[model samples]
Target: MQIEPMATATEPTRKIVQRDPARTRARILKAAIAEFSAKGYSGARTVQIATRAKSNIRMLYHYFGGKDALYVRVLEEVLLRLRAAELQLDFESMEPTDGILKMFDFIDTHFGARPELRRLLAFENMNQARHLNRSAVIRDAASPVLGHIANLLRRGEQAGVFRPGIDALHLYTAMVSLAYYSRAHAPTLSRIFGTDLLCHQWQADHHAQSHQMLLGFLSRPTTA
Candidate 1:
């Protein structure tokens, strides 16, 4: 009698592997953000981002198509994240001046936490079309908040809390200028001031001073 292969009572079974696409995608995005922020769109390399994400370039392309598409996705994700955080603010509860102060505090803290974000945004400013074309969702999401902020300015003017004849658009641009310039040019400012302007202590002082300066300007009486 020819003996066939005998079945073992205790056979090891192969385990099924499951990959978390969401987690992997998030990791890729975060890595891409850092890469793009540092090197910008043209200089950024997919291999470096993949290595940082503990992934491979093939997967990155599979998820985001290519480098340009990946860059756009990263931009969209960051813009959405920032907008979501800002939208949660309880603007109605605070006085107009206090709301403006809070805005400064928010910018200082948020931008401080993510210097890379400012870098990426600065890069976008250099190539407006490349980034702006991918920013439709961001603009749509921001429209309501912008409108709300404009309304707040109108209310403040009417209440005599802010000076009359100050354009809301101008004021908004001014606030953004103060925040963006401080952080974006921190290195140059640090060299000029002979101190690190990006330090937490410096940022705190700057934030307070900026808020005071803006409030003072807004409260000034208009010339006849």
Candidate 2:
């Protein structure tokens, strides 16, 4: 004797909307990189980034908190990307010379191909590292790469292929300096030398020279 009520005529049907937070966050991050790189941290606007991302500013704030926080996230992201790429080097398992050569080639290839990375690094330096200092994530991200370099140097020294007394971090810095400087100063260097270092042949030449220089540096005997 129980009666069940059917749908009422005046009742409204409910519709559900699904939101993809990961995709939205990625879009925001991508847009933020372009805006931050082009304008530097201070000049980049959340609204502009949102517009570029085809998102709204509220979502940006909701996702990242604020401009400084977003910049920190961008730095964290860029550093993480660099760390990830660096981690792909199997230098630790290879012969020392081969490892060094591979490391150099990898650096050159990465920098030459990824201009956005260069721009983001340039922006970071432009701010005197204000935003980078805000992120512990970046520092942690750098640790493994640095450790890899140290291990490589130690192995090279042990195997008698590389000289002792060279600090791993220092050598790593040297390698980065040599690799990064080319792309970082390409415009001016190209203008000054009247040659496009960005071109394949030129970069190939530079890459060979870099490998030679690093090998020579590693080959020198340690003083007693």
Q: Which residue segments of model 2 deviate by more than 4 Å?
A: 1-16, 222-224
- Of the candidates shown, which would achieve the greatest lDDT relative to the real structure? 2
Error of 1 at 13 (Å): 2.9
Please count the clashing residue pairs in each candidate, in the order shown. 0, 0
RMSD of 2: 4.8
Candidate 1, pairs of clashing residues: none
CA lDDT, candidate 2, residue 36: 88
